[model samples]
Target: MTIDTSDGTPAASPDRPATPKTTPKKTLRPRNRKAQIITVAREQFGRSGYHNVSMEGIASAVGITAGALYRHFPNKQELLAQAMLDGSSSILAILDEVDRTDSKVVFTALVRYGLDNNFRSLLFDQEARNLTPERRTEARAGVREVTSRVAAALRHERPDLSVPDSVVLGWALTSIAFSPARHRTTLPRKRFEALLARLFDVVRTAPALPEEPAAQPQPTSNFSHTSRRESLMGAAITLFDQRGYRSVTMDDIGSAAGVPSSSIYTHFGSKAEVLQAILARGNETLRLGLVQALRNADSREDAIARVVHSYTNSVISPDSAIAILIEETANLPEEAQASTHIAQREYIDEWVHLLGNETADARATVLATISMINDLTRVRLESRQCAIEDLAVRILATQTV
Candidate 1:
């Protein structure tokens, strides 16, 4: 016989009551959690700019408390730096995987990779400047490396083109590939890729423009004490374009406008307000110009040419504020961002109408064509007016495959 247990007959408890079996609570390991945090942070930082995204926001996105987020990243800056590094690393890996000897092959690979990893492209373009100087330099080096490789490949394939032309073309093609990142467009992946490849071929075969002195932007007579508010807006746009929205301070804007820092509050409540005003003015400018172009045109083709000329001229004009408006709108406050986007949508819709594109895919193709025109401004080409109009006509006439 067995001896009885001394503790309340627990040895025979199975006969009295059965203990229920429980599953173990699943938990993410530290490495997996860290990876999750980076991925979520990248998406958040890409969607909303670095200044707009908070540590708490990222932590919430990762389904973790802020304290836990600190355990992984010492601060938001570190998180941003790491996110940029991760993106650059991934992009460089893709570049390495491609056959870099063939310009067309490299471009197709990069376009596909950029489209597939659109968020990463957005992060690099929009938020990379938020990093510290040292970190920014590091991120920039990776970009330059990609550009250099592409330029090298172009040199190999297009022996007829000069070194500088090949380099600029490389940059332009990259810009075209990354255009989808800036706009919200839905298309079948295969179709979009094919369209992008066709676009690349068009740009590749297009004759290179001779590098000429860019026309000096005429001095604006609008920036006087009587136009202090306009002066400040102009100053802010320049600063924002040069240093980015997040990097600029109110005092900086004030100083640039030759006004005391305290005086800025008289015109705008906050920095975001200043940005909103700038964007509103830019939207109004473009809208008015487009309306005028439409009124003056004898035909749809003429309207398109006039619109393209108006846009490119505005971009090069000293007082034109569209660059900052296009690039920094994401840094605006939520309400302002919404309104600005609505304005942008109206602009694009007008283009779609002009293009006679009724379907969603056609609308996307129209936007891409517009993007190609915009990208041309990045290179130093002579006769910008004629170049822009010719390109616009060609792009509009070309059917998306």
Candidate 2:
């Protein structure tokens, strides 16, 4: 009888090429294959975006056949949803053990957990967007539960903060803690943990948030829809931001811009070109911000502060261009993706060079600071409060620490 290996490959037999007599290699299929599948799926999904990864790729990584993977997950969507939900559940389990009342105790536990399982928070942000509306909501509900627990702990520690402020701080803490996952941080594990602890302290002692001011009116475009090409670009960005780039169609863009779908070709060759245009505009905006920040700064310290504020303003504003620049670039064609990535890297390098710390750890810390600020401010629409921007500058300006 032919024996099958745990990896779903059949053992070599006489019908195959003759071979020297040897024992068949043992494949230990772990009893907890489901857990292992989820773990591998999370890493793959986080490293490569949801659309880029395939079930076969994930199964191969997990040392199982595609058939075996299917037994655990019905489709890629289920894997995406379950991986995040399971990750959140793991965090919830950790929260259950800690003293959730003491903010310090809770913060320490969360930081340690985040360091160990860094990818969980990232999947919650980018990959969850690929899920169906109901699945996405279910996955996010788990994250909200984790956030609320931390916010409650903050309230217990500091009573002066309003409910909204505490919740904001809660999210800030979580974002800061898990930010290392977004970059390659080469810091000694202990030192990195200490850095996170200090950042939590920074937020912990921050002044109580003030009442939210009235919503400011957006600036009117000087040439609003006067040009067909510009109008199509604007419509494409909004659609891509609200839905993902893959889900938005050329027809959708044309309809939103008040043009015939075929007429979209007159201005833009394809959807990819439209996306490339939107990202190009965003890159130019950042370049200009950097220039202005440098030109107006009184000193090196002032330059860093100015840059941080400039970036925070770009991220916190209602404009969808920044969001598209950040999230949708992955869908661009290979050459376009490379160009966008190079621009983004150079932008970060400017800040690192400004800090005069070229070490890997410094770059990693700066990256985490920028990513934490962007993520914390964008998680909730209400999180656009000016106080969050202040906190963001505070976080990045402390890179010397």
lDDT of all predictions:
0.74, 0.79
**Model 1 residue 285 lDDT?**
88
Q: What value does the lDDT take at residue 143 in candidate 2?
A: 79
* Poorest stretch of ten by lDDT in candidate 1: 378-387
Mark the regions of model 1 whose C-alpha exceeds 4 Å error after superposition: 1-35, 120-124, 210-225, 242-252, 261-265, 292-302, 330-335, 369-393
Question: How do the residues 108-141 of candidate 2 rate in per-residue lDDT, one tens digit apiece?
Answer: 8777887787654532376666889999899888
- Give the per-residue lDDT of model 1 (tens digit) for 172-267: 666667767657887778887877777677667667644455778978796446677887898998888777888899999999998787788999
Instruction: In angstroms, give how far residue 328 of model 2 lies from its true place.
Output: 2.3
Q: Give the true-structure RMSD of model 2.
A: 7.0
The number of the candidate with the highest TM-score is 2
- The residue pairs in collision within model 2 are none
**How high is the lDDT of residue 391 in model 1?**
50
RMSD, one per candidate, in order? 4.8, 7.0
